[model samples]
Target: MSYDKEVGLRMNWPMIVYISLVHIVACYSIYNTITRPHYMLTYVWTIILWFISGFGITAGAHRLWSHRSYKARYPLRVLLMIFNSIANQGSVIHWVRDHRLHHLYSDTDKDPHDSQRGFFYSHVGWLLVRKPKRVLDAGRKISLNDLYKDNILLIQHRLCPWWNMLWCFIFPAIVGYYLWDESILNGILLPGVFRYCFVLHATWCVNSVVHQWGPKPYDNKSHTTENGIVAFIALGEGWHNYHHTFDWDYVTAEMGAIKQYNPTKVFIDIMYYLGLAYNLRRAYPKGWEHLKSRNIRKLGGEYHVVEGIYGIPPFCHRTVTYVQGEGGGGGRLLSETQVDNMSTTDEEGL
Candidate 1:
């Protein structure tokens, strides 16, 4: 496969060094975990911080900010911004910029994490290497007007260095020293470095494993797919095929029910009940059926349609246009009239 443009690789020494140190310290922390079993408080703190930081990326950077799947209140935005710094992925502004471009130009050289490049490059190697020129150029073409207008994102981006130090290191160490009565060095290494590395790898799994493996129940035109393991660990981000097909849907997956492993969707629901989120966008069931019917890969018998979990009712009437054209000619359009009929047919068959 050829790309419209090519991006030569460059070394990002700072990122390389930072990642190397984190891994080294994380390995050392493993020894601490085995020998120092009395620091149960530190282990608990690591787990809590891991959840907060992971949610920060999945809920804040990916869904709310990158896709604008729903509107969040000011307080929710502030909370997400704080936790996002602890995640240490990057500033929300740059993170959102890269993500939007990845969706727009997926699998191409312009994509920030081009999965076609192979697992290592897509997983974390992209971060270690200097961003390709095409990525930067294509990112500029994306409209981040909404993100720029966001005061919370602006403040986080401006004070990112300070915030990262305070939340990712200083705060954790302080809590460990004062509250847990543990060595500050131990605090920094265990919960700080180890937790950060764990969350980082889990998030990266969605970019690498979910794309390279798993079932593509939705669209297969792209490399993205749905993986249950990644969804559980990434807090609902693993439904990559459904996400790419319906990017505006808040849940990122078709099944948003409580039984689903999408904790992020549940969190958004909680926010909605508390009036912290509104105008939640979701894919229409009829639209999903229309898309599924045209899917290059057929869904197996195990697949069944449920009332879309967003509480939106299925449309009784819908129109699907099939266009025929060659070389950009004005195509003839065919509209199917029996939209409800087709859905009923599918349901009865299921």
Candidate 2:
């Protein structure tokens, strides 16, 4: 997170103050949770709330809305909206709009949270400062016409912070108070504020950590990676290489949820089983093997095959990195299919 490209941008005081106070409250809540064992239940509630809020992003905003990896019935859409509102990273329209921009421009100067600038900018500094004119211009070119069609999305966006507050903060606190006799103060600070803060950082890791670290299976070009530690914490979003290369894949990773901790996929699958989600999609890309082999030869290391957590065993694949450090790749996703459509010639087997 050392890098910074915020040189000419104006500071956003309101966002700065909100973020500053959020961290302060979140840290104080942690201290309270530690010193006051009586708040154990509240702490547990925080963990539970974190999962719920995370789903709103992983399932609702990023996958369902941003990429449309699957279609949801009205009931499911409404539920996802409520779930996302609880997360409050942004309303659906804004989240999808910015996320689409991120995928479109990726690490370029036009990318909203371009990783090329540095980890801090990609993770959270983008919010602290106004975006450069180049980024804002590209963002305008990327349309949100589809999102605007959803009246529910319009309502949420119209209400803005208040809608966010109702679900993310007030509702969680209300639940804690009624369910466990928790005081509104503790409920708000711990589960509402601290949990929100925790999820924010976890979500941000996909932008910063995976881009800088992890192995890139799909290619050896972009800074994206297949990060397991990130997937573990960020609910499978750490499959950055795959997600960036093949955004249509609802599972995000090529492997199923059992191979990784993708509760978000599990939730979507459950929704599908219940007939609330349909048109689930996946991509059938070619040249994965060719790309892997080519990169392996380029990097010039002896090859071995194995499957461990996010490929940490023999530390190699046909061309992808099973372990970490150098010799990996990622790309930008585009269109409703979320397909990069990268082409490669067929290669002889190694």
Candidate 3:
């Protein structure tokens, strides 16, 4: 199956069937809630599962695995792997592969979920249709060497199908059944199917809504934007513009304070304090200030300021050390001012 120019658009039947069934079940669950509401416990369970699965994708797959934003202890890594499986997007390796490609060629033909293809395609249409040759070719060029070195990630990928089924469907349904003492059917429909559907769409919204809406305060070269609504639903992943600009930042935004909606950063911070995570990476203060000063949205008078717990750090003129663990490589200690001056044309432009 391919979507190359010569091959045209080919339907990915497996994905199509899976998505269709989930939606159908979700719709039925909605009707069930309206007509014959389940015990409040069932609703509560659904919301809980939604957060768990959503955070799994945001913190586990996106930040931890894909970006290697920080190092985690073995126990924390295993826990996040379980959460990632429960999210049911894909194995860690597969998710990181496509995500790295998306960042490398975002908003372009090579991007798997290119916004230029329109909202639907970027959101979920890309999944229903086969991957384009350009996307596949680009993905192959991106390195997964770091991920391959991680035993936890490799083990999870090897057993993904089994764990995904267990954590995503079986475990959630069992919890629902035991908590509400309801029919197994009710448990599967409400917490399993409905919750899965909700989390999937919420994650997809970052690819769709985040690109189409919000302000591009980091870089206007891409269509990605900062969407607070999406950040709230996607568990702190909605700061798309900032993310595209500073792809290596563990916080995913310039503002790293906890009072913001970035629960993922908070989670990582907690792990760091507990000695379960370390080498937390973030954008340099000088680079962030430079980008903020030159924000296209601000220049156009369309950017709105939202006060948060931490303002942007003041600019630094002293020499800076460029550490590497966030993007999965060795550190390079360069002069901070020199790096800031060169950042405009460097691979990771501020």
Return the top candidate by TM-score: 2
Candidate 3 global CA lDDT score: 0.75
Candidate topping lDDT: 1
* lDDT by residue (tens digit), candidate 1, 20-118: 988998899888777775378888998888888887998899999999999899999999988899888879999989899999888888889999999
lDDT of each: 0.77, 0.77, 0.75
- lDDT comparing candidate 1 with the true structure: 0.77
User: Residue 128 of candidate 2: its Cα lDDT?
Assistant: 92
Q: Say which prediction, candidate 1 or candidate 3, comes out ahead on lDDT.
A: 1
- lDDT per residue (tens digit) for residues 1-350 in model 2: 23345566799899999999999998998887677644567778778888888998999999999998999999988888888898998788888888999888788887878888789989999889887887788888888888899987888899998999889988978888888888887888888988899899999999899999976657546789877788888888887887787877888877677665678889999999999999988763443444444544433334322233434432222233232233323322122111122233322233
Worst 10 residues of 1 by lDDT: 310-319
Off by over 4 Å in 2: 1-7, 37-40, 284-350
Q: Each model's TM-score?
A: 0.81, 0.82, 0.80
Q: Give the per-residue lDDT of model 3 (tens digit) for 131-206.
A: 9877888888989998899898888789878878788888877876776676677778878888888889999999
After TM-score superposition, what is the CA distance of residue 151 in candidate 1 from its true location, in Å? Answer: 1.4
Error of 1 at 157 (Å): 0.6
